[model samples]
Every structure is written in structure tokens, then in C-alpha cells.
Target: MSSVDVTTVGRGPGLVVLPGATRRARHYGAMATALSEMYTVHVVERRGRGRSPAQDSSYCLDAEISDALEVLTETGSKQIFGHSYGGLIALHVALRTDLDRVIAYEPGVSIGNTMPRSWMPRYEQLLAEGKDARAMVHFLHTCEFMPGGALVTAMVWAMQRFAAEGRATRELLPTVVRELHEIYALDSDGSRYGAITAPVLLLGGGRSPAYIKQMLPLLVDVIPNAKLVVTPEFDHNAPDLGHPAAVADLIRA
Candidate 1:
């Protein structure tokens, strides 16, 4: 496994930020800049992206959490912010470590039974057949569940941009494909996260689609000391741009 490269800025308490799947720490540049005003922001560069090393292909979620722990231990920071898959990693970290507080933005696909068990396998097949964009479509569809309107058009536009930019073929591809099975294989008993005692801030976009919309309540039920923040006018990318200030408020809160 590769070690995460942490960039420190500002003063006060320490706050480590973990990005979602397929995105890099720089993707959180705006939030990092905002958070840097009050806290020492350590933007974690997860394996296979940024300055981190390439993933071993046999890696699992536990390994990813270990990496975050290593960053926390080295940085001596107890506060963490995880977005999407990173949120899931943060949730698992909270269960294992003694963090002061954690902010998780939409963790699980199975949290609301929105993803089918066979999805990952089909994605794997598509990848093997060199249908990388098709595979991406499947994953995106699962998250967005596009409706027949502007949302659908937006989804299409995003997918086109993603493909044109070779987003799926980036440094995170191999690891994303290999570890997806690990995510799919996780048992949906919900009891696994019941042990987490850290205060969690659950942030979800009101316009993020039905599947992600469904994740909010499910997460509230699973986490003991958690508060939900629903950004009504935003979607997944809301954290990136549409509502950076709002997201910063949540991080700083």
C-alpha cells in the first residue's frame, strides 16, 4: 500500500480531509482553502492518486482505513472529513480509532438497498471487455438514478465530460475496479457501524438523486451521534463548486 501525502496549511486544530472515489485531494481545493482559515488542513492524497503510491490491486477497504489512520497518527489529527467512498472509509476509521469528530458525506450504497449485488460483477465484466465508459455509466447510474428531465440531460452531459476527459482511465482505475468487489461484499447487517462513538456530520445533497437521497435517513439510523445536512439546491458536485461555502460551513461547524 502507498502512503498518503499530506499538505498542511493554516493553524489551530488539525483536520484531515479524504476525497471521494476517482477524485484527488486537489479536488477539495476550495474546501481545503476555506478550512485552512481556522484549522491545520491536511488534505490526504489517497493511494493511486496525487503523490500517493499505486494500489496493490489486492487491496481492501480495511487497508484504505489503515492508510487514513496512518495519516491521522502521523499528523496527530483527530478530526476527519470524508466524502462519498472516503466517507465510508472515515466511518470505518471512527469505528476503529478514537477521533474527536468526523464528517461523512454519504457512505454506503447498501445503506438504502439501492445497489444490487450483481452490479459490481457486471462492472468487472464490462471493464474486462474494455467497456470502460460503459462500466462508468453503470456506476454513475447507480449513484444518480437519472430521472427523465433536466437531471437526465445533466447526467448525460457529465458522462460525456467524464469520458472525454478520460476520468475513468486515471490513476485510480485499477484500484477502483479491484476494491469495488470489497465494497459490494460488505454485509448489510448495519451493526458493523453501531460501535462508532465519534460525533458524525452527515452531509447529503438534496438534489443528488434518489439513491443518494435515500442514503441520508439510512445513515442517520445507523450512526448514534450524527446530524444530517441536506443541501437542497445541490448534488454530489455541490461540494466541489455549487455550494463550497455551504460545505465549508459544515466542515467548520
Candidate 2:
């Protein structure tokens, strides 16, 4: 918690954002730009990304959540928005900390009985072997689901294309692969949400994976003071595609 560097925008109460493991704070530039105009936005760079500290070994969700809390304390912002794995961290923060409010955008921690039981260990092995492309492809085909099969296929294709150039993809790939263990370690049985007293906005994309849809209602049941926001026009990655103004307005409300 000592001297964690933060990239701030605007000037007001803190509104810290935690990006997905594969994305850096810079990737949320569009959202930060808009949110900054209204409230001071602190985009957490996450450990090991950019100038942040280097992650020398394995990672855990608790550690990631602690990093987010560090940002919150550093910026003094109780309002937080977490996307994907970031959302999972936000949820943990709400459960474990005194964050004024939180917005979790489509966290994929729930696999239920639908997921292939073998995928986790296999992914771990691939990651250990340094076969990231193969690992990512495996994750997409099995665990990278986002509701509709067609859309998942398209998104996976795009990600694969981007990942084809190893150098271009190296920056985030290690984090993504290394953090898989942490993400899977999350317990989404709804027990953790009972501790959250803040007004939580659970945002989901209609076109997201069926598992995501299945998990949404569960979140409502667990988070004491929470509401649902389903956006049919956007998918899991929509927040990065200019949805922050709308999101900021929701937070402001």
C-alpha cells in the first residue's frame, strides 16, 4: 500500500477503475477522459503492467483486490468500476472493504456445472509450458464464452488475430495467462456478496455468455443493496468502446 502510483484525471471524489488482467489502465482512456470531466478518475495500472511493479511469480485474486484497494486509499475514492476480472476484484473489495459503491461489469467467475472440469488444469499446464497461443485458443474454445456461440467465435477470432504477432501481444499475455489461476480461484457461490452494503450496479450484456446470464441473478441475490443493468447493445467489452459516459452518469445517479 506504500506509494502505488496512480494516473488521475479531473478533480473531485475518487472514482478508481480496475481494468481486466489483459488490459492496462491506458486502455480505458476513453472512459477515463469522460469520467474525469465529472469526477476525479484514478485508473489503477495494476501490478506488473506499464511502470507498475513487476509480478515475479503466481498471482491471486486477493492480491489483485488488494491492489485495487491500494488505489482507492491512495486516491481516496470510494466509487469503483471493475470490468471482467477487474469486476471480480471490485466485488471482493465490496465484500472486504468500505467502498462507497461498486459497479461490476460482467465478471466471469462463475462456471457452474456447465464448464468443462478438465479445462482448469489443462490451462495451467499450457501456461506453465509457455504455450500462450495454444492456451488462449483453448480458453476461448472452452472457457472464453460470452453467451451466443457465434459472437464468441468472432471475438475469439479477433483476439487470436491480434495475438498472432507474439511481440505485439507479449505485454498483456503473461498477465492474462498467469492470472488465470487467480480468477479461477474466486468463489462465486454468493456467500461473499452478503457482506457488501454499498449500492452495487451489476451490469450485464444480453449477448454475453449463457453462463454470465446465469450468474447475474445470483449476484443480485447475494449483493445486499444492488440493481441490475442489462445492455443489449453492448457485450462484455462494451465499456472500453465509449460506454463510460453512460456509466459515469449511472454512478453519479
Best by lDDT: 1
lDDT agreement of model 2 with the native:
0.71
Give the per-residue lDDT digits (tens) of candidate 2, residues 38-149.
Answer: 7898888877776777667755676777787777877678899988888878887877788778888886456444223466677668768866556656665575452335
Tell me the deviation in Å of residue 16 in model 2: 0.6
| Residues 86-193 of candidate 1: C-alpha lDDT, one tens digit per residue | 888888899899999998776654653554555677767877886655666676665454333446545544665567445543435556665556667674756677
Per-model CA lDDT versus the true structure: 0.73, 0.71
In model 1, where do residues sit more than 4 Å from their true spots?
145-169
For all candidates, the clash counts are 0, 5
What are the clashing pairs of model 1?
none
